[model samples]
Target: FIRLMAKPEKLGDLREPRAYLTTIANGLVSDHWRRQSVEQTYLDALTLYPTEHQPSEEQRALPIELLLQLNTLLQQMKPLIRSTFLLSQLDGLTYRQIADQLHVSERTVKSYMAQAMLHCLRLKNQTDN
Candidate 1:
């Protein structure tokens, strides 16, 4: 990790090496907790989905490659754009409704949706090839 952070000479010159490492470790730990929380929330929400409308076993079992590609694509989007996409697709919100909920203009909501769609389409194209 030190080698990854900087050259050895620069790494050795840090006045508070313990503090530096502590900060990095804390950040990594916090990110892990955050991801765990998000995964738990997603799993919990899955129980609320209507059984009649739920995806079939095959549909639910997306290839790991495609899942990773989609995750990468979503992570690259701005928070607002990602939220807009989720609210529209997952929550079944209209553009106007999302705009009102997000305190943004309808045009902004549309723009965010377009940005998210383009990102997903690009990812899909890459995965398809």
Candidate 2:
């Protein structure tokens, strides 16, 4: 691993440090990617599991697992875009309310909302299939 990371020039008779570091870095990246893949696979499996039923008192807009997934997806978005989308859609804010809060024009607010909706829909379609 270190050898790859170091990418050392061929040594006539001695090893170089760069090759070693490069090798190590390559291994780390591969391992990191593997771990991420495993995590995503697990999360996907969890999405298929049925949520527990709550009493009338505990029912909510979405099940906990679904909400967690949504939160994770939202994290991928730019913060301002996410905020605008959530405020307008989830929180039921009007376009004017969103514009006032962000101090942007109403047209800008509408544009942000459209972009966010498209991103969300694309993500949903991918996951659903």
Winner by lDDT: 1
> Could you give candidate 1's per-residue lDDT for residues 63-126 as a string of tens digits?
4334444556767899999999999999999999999999999999999999999998987787
Best by TM-score: 1
Whole-model Cα lDDT of every candidate shown, in order: 0.79, 0.73
lDDT of 2: 0.73
Kindly give the stretch of ten consecutive residues in candidate 2 with the minimal lDDT sum. 53-62
Compute each candidate's TM-score over C-alphas.
Answer: 0.53, 0.52
- What local lDDT score does residue 62 receive in model 2, on the 0 to 100 scale? 38
**What ranges in model 1 sit over 4 Å off?**
1-67
